[model samples]
Target chain A: MGLSLKTAVAIIEAALARGHELRLAPLTVAVLDAGGHLVALQREDNSGILRVEIASGKAWGALGMGIGSRELGERATKVPHFFNALAAASQGRLVPVAGGVLVRDASGIIGAVGISGDTSDNDEACALAGIAAAGLVGQTGARPAEA
Target chain B: MGLSLKTAVAIIEAALARGHELRLAPLTVAVLDAGGHLVALQREDNSGILRVEIASGKAWGALGMGIGSRELGERATKVPHFFNALAAASQGRLVPVAGGVLVRDASGIIGAVGISGDTSDNDEACALAGIAAAGLVGQTGARPAEA
Candidate 1:
């Protein structure tokens, strides 16, 4: 099933609230359904004009690659040229960073959340917090522990 | 000054309310600042995947051309080749149609709103209703009355 607007708004609100509690800069949040289409977006006042695109790119990249942006970032370092080309292929929508996280449920991934306006790690933390607050599992694309 | 997130959200809510009263199809609304940057956007559940981009394109065209998209449509009829080239140059962001309306106040043009998922005329009507509900002026870019 697709992500509902109500659920998307809840994620954005909780993410913003978490950012506020952490005293981060003004943040922008974008929620994208599994199809990588925008369901909702909010750009805080005084945020950069490009923040909407940036936030959406992060989540879109995660959804497109079937992995969180953190893992994408890790891969980018090993294959910089390929990632650069991928960015061009996606019309600059693929942002390999840490702030894009996938939302999961028993059925599978339903959507993703992307945040901007702080350290990438901090942004991802907020995303995870928001996902948890909404009672959804967040897949951060971290490497699994080896035996 | 730029439009605040609160004001943008209010416009979207009121526009959706209008659409609901009229029983229109699922709708998408986008608000863009004078710089043609998205401030906020929402795509209702079951709306087409491209609804967000279509809505954003309409509002972005209005902001970029400094006129509501209704006027852009009229102008496009007179210069089909030019309009086609303009659309190409804007990377498909320019949508000349009736649903895009400019938001204004005593200070001047601040932003534009675009709606989709109904007849263009009906979409424009909803946009006007929303702007009025928010206590703002709406410019439909209609032809001026001749003296």
Candidate 2:
């Protein structure tokens, strides 16, 4: 089943709360449905305008690949040349880093949540918080539920 | 005083190289002049179809505002409600996140690069790589020389 918009919002809200508690810098959060369509997006004021896109891109990548952005980053490190070339080939729509988590319900992959405006590790933490708040698991594996 | 097409291409090339090295999935890359004009675009064969638009949006936001997309992301956090409304108002053209970098030459703001397909953090890394490849600094607060 596809990720519900309501669930996506809940995830975002929960993540924001944690960010606030941590006094993390302004953050941008985006949730993409299984189909990769944007279900919800929130950009905090004082956060750079680009955070919205960054958050969305990460989530989009995760939903599209059924994996975490962190995995993509690790891969990029191995083949720097090819990854750089692909960056040019994609026309500026590929990001492979942490801070994005795939959303899953009992059935299967539902959607994804991406966070920006903090360190990569911190971004991932916020994303995990969002997923946990939704009462779902944020997992990493060879075959994640596809969007 | 603007981002030359050649430099833009080089930036994309470097970004892709990084992606492949890490075995990250396909990606899309986009570069924009300080005026937010398209300079170069690329999409890998395996990249998702939506990456193109996402990349463009991030670059556009960066170039339009003359700042790193990451900075924009922070601003969005303070005024999340307004930011959300603005995202809707922009009709998907505005991303406002950290995956985009403002390109700067000795003269000044030349262009911005945006990369998608991986994660927002990965996208930002690739964008930074492209900036370095172009022999320019991706500064947060700089106006375009041409402007």
Candidate 3:
């Protein structure tokens, strides 16, 4: 099944609420369906304009690679040139970063979530909180030390 | 406010419904935010594989130029070289055609909706119908003869 708009909004709201609870900086969140198409997005006031692009790129990269951005980041380090070519090919849509996570239902991957504005670690933590709050799975590498 | 997934879906559904009503053909509809980010897209069964890209390019061009693709098509005819340069600069993201319509709210332009899979006129008619059905404004220079 596709990611419902209601669920996408819930995920965004939960992420914002978690960020508020943790006192993280204002954040931008993007939720993309399996095809790397945006389902919903939110850019908190005062968040830099680039935040939305960064979040979208991260989520697009995660969905494109079928893995979280943290794992993609590791892979990028191993094969930088290939990823660079990919970035050009995708028109700069791929972003190998730490705050993109795969969203899954019991059936399998349904979508992904990306967050920006705070440190990558904190952004990831907030994304995880939102995914969990929505009763969906968020797949990523182990939490970083800062998170 | 940005285009929500719910509204995007409504647009797509309405377009597809109109397509069926007219018995044009299976269609593909794409919705993009003002930032030219994919909000949601659907390729109807039996629609050509390229329909998605065509729809996206139309919407992207409309959002990028702050005008409907019909107007963009007219401008392209007037300055083919400039339009060609824009296509290169945008990496083929812009399609100066007749099926893209701008989506506006009371405040201002929010995004665009594009449709493909039938004649361009029929596609634009469906897009306009979708935008209207979604409770948004759809602006184009004028209805094409066929539409």
Q: lDDT scores for all predictions?
A: 0.88, 0.73, 0.83
- Candidate 2 is graded, for docking, as incorrect
- Give me the runs in candidate 1 sitting further than 4 Å from their true place: A142-147, B142-147
lDDT of 1 by residue, A32-80 (tens): 9998999999988877878887789889899989999989989999999
Q: Choose the strongest candidate by DockQ.
A: 1
Error of 1 at B51 (Å): 1.0
Superposed on the true interface residues, model 2 gives a C-alpha RMSD in angstroms of: 11.7
lDDT of 2 by residue, B32-106 (tens): 876677889999998888888888888877754446677778876743432343344345566777787887767
* Deviation of model 1 at A98, angstroms: 0.6
lDDT score, candidate 3, position B34: 79
Compare the candidates by TM-score and give the number of the best one: 1
| All candidates: CA RMSD (Å) | 2.5, 14.2, 6.0
Sliding window of 10 residues with minimal summed lDDT for model 1 chain A: A138-147
* DockQ for all models: 0.82, 0.04, 0.10
Q: In model 2, which runs have C-alpha deviations exceeding 4 angstroms?
A: A85-91, A140-147, B1-147
- Distance (Å) between predicted and true CA of B36, model 3? 4.9
Q: TM-score for all predictions? A: 0.94, 0.52, 0.62
Ranking by TM-score: 1, 3, 2
